[model samples]
Target: MYFPFRQLLASSLALTALTIPARAQISIGEPIPFTDTFSGTLLDDTFLVLTAWRTDTGSVNGGLFGRTFVGLTNEPVGEATVSAQSSTTAPNFFMARNSASLSVENAEAARYTTQSSHGTHTQVEFFTPTSLTPARTRFHWNVSGLTSSTYPGVVTNADLRFAAGYFPTTSYYDFFDLATQENGGPLMSVSGTGAFSYNLPLLLNQPIDLFYHTVAYVGFTAEGGETFSGFSDFSNTHILDRIELFDSNDVLISEWGMREISSGQVMFDQNGRTAAANGGNNIPEPGTLGLLALGGAALLGRVCRRTKKGN
Candidate 1:
């Protein structure tokens, strides 16, 4: 379930000083699998933040960047309305799930400024509480979605974008604008079912955060006052049927199922027992990375704006 940023921040800060014990080095051919099928009524509590925003603007610095917080109360099924600068142009963006999958979409089209632009951005993140330093790692997942834009008039730019990947560290400045190096080399291109396995160049002992992000953007100059509409439609849906992780020899190192994630039992190892269960060790709590990243982005934006003004 989703927790408020304030509550999550407080808890994360309190646990910041705690240390996470490194897992025993997983050897090849040892089964230590981790898998997750979205069969639960709620997203795993390890998902610390869910956020979305829409913007309409006449100038780069003059857009109304409306932001919204998605709560766990509506999980397994819910939608939030993204308001545009104009009163008549509200669009509904939803993040819903059933016993089988999680879906994200913006059903209604957003209206763009007659001679400017409009866009929507959504992101969700999952925190890894433990440190995994396996010599070799394999990652796999599934997805199906589409984005479209309709401009009854003239247009200069239009596009829909989606990206999924993980951060090696718990801290980040921007979720949507992460540099390639920040996401562990290259970001995963999420479309159909895909998987990749690679050997580590060095031992990694810190926890990582997995993230999924999407953007629907359009820029146009209306002709004869004709309006423009655009959206990211995934009605067919994106399903995380299963996410499995394995070591070099294809042995399971750790696994997560919908039930375990939904219930916040995210700190488990190969034997299906949490660190606490193995002994008294506790996984390091994650900070409010989502909010912190957004704040950093805003600050960076302001800095860039001031520099532009100076020029």
Candidate 2:
């Protein structure tokens, strides 16, 4: 009996080891399509946002601060919109559009600031369950149609830009660091294809602790101005069709996307990962726990036989 039980226990342990799935690149699929990926319309849900309209903050120019949507849609407020904007501020949203176009044409008239000569166009922060590594994770985004005249009387130095702390940085809050902005980071742009792309390859693979990290967030401010006068009216249009995350194998791990679905409400996505991305059991996994119990039973049976023989 002893010999058989020992053999059985060893076999069970071997089986458990075999069953554990090897670690691979985490690939979480797109769970939901925002009623309008944050167009912030009547149908939109699960967003944490604060907006102002026709109001001027007199904030520091080229800095992201004052009345920005700092906590805009995150996982905590899933399926319900959490927002505060001026009552008079009409919602600048439309039904979900295919392939994002981030040019002046699609530029939201309601910007971070309403001050004419100085303003911030747009700002968004994305904090996800998974933090991307410079080596293992690569980002792919597309841009189509760059037009400067979309905004009336504004076409000088008109450019479409994103926050520099976007991909490499983990904290959504770092975007507001005045010093970081002072670096005059290069603007968001693509090669001159009818539609261009933003694809950067890292020099070394820098990995951050998973889940505890921040996704990137940046503000887009197109300051269209003249040499003598400061930025007057700002205007630029761009269509951002896709934002994809890939692995070394060139497989898509996640996607921040633009799409339309049929019936069901979209699931919550923190950045590219799902709301449940950052979670784990402190104890052994379920299968391992069960195997441990079976081993204990086998050991008890062996002890019972020895006691009976002594009696």
Tens-digit lDDT string for candidate 2 (27-83): 221111111011111111111222221111111111121112222221222222222
lDDT of each: 0.25, 0.22
Tens-digit lDDT string for candidate 1 (1-311): 11111101112222223222223112221111111011111111222223222111111112112222222222221232222211111121211111111122332222121111112222222233335434333332333334344543312211111233333332211333443334665443332222322222222343233333321122222222333344333333332223344445565556332112222433333333343323321212322333334321232121100011110
Instruction: List residue ranges in candidate 2 displaced over 4 A.
Output: 1-157, 164-194, 200-237, 254-311
**Best by the TM-score measure:** 1
Report residue 69 deviation for candidate 2 (angstroms): 20
CA shift at 158, candidate 2, in angstroms?
3.9
Instruction: Assess every candidate by TM-score.
Output: 0.35, 0.24
lDDT of 2: 0.22
Q: Show the lowest summed lDDT stretch of 10 residues, model 1.
A: 302-311
* Prediction 1 global C-alpha lDDT: 0.25
| Model 1 CA lDDT for position 203 | 24
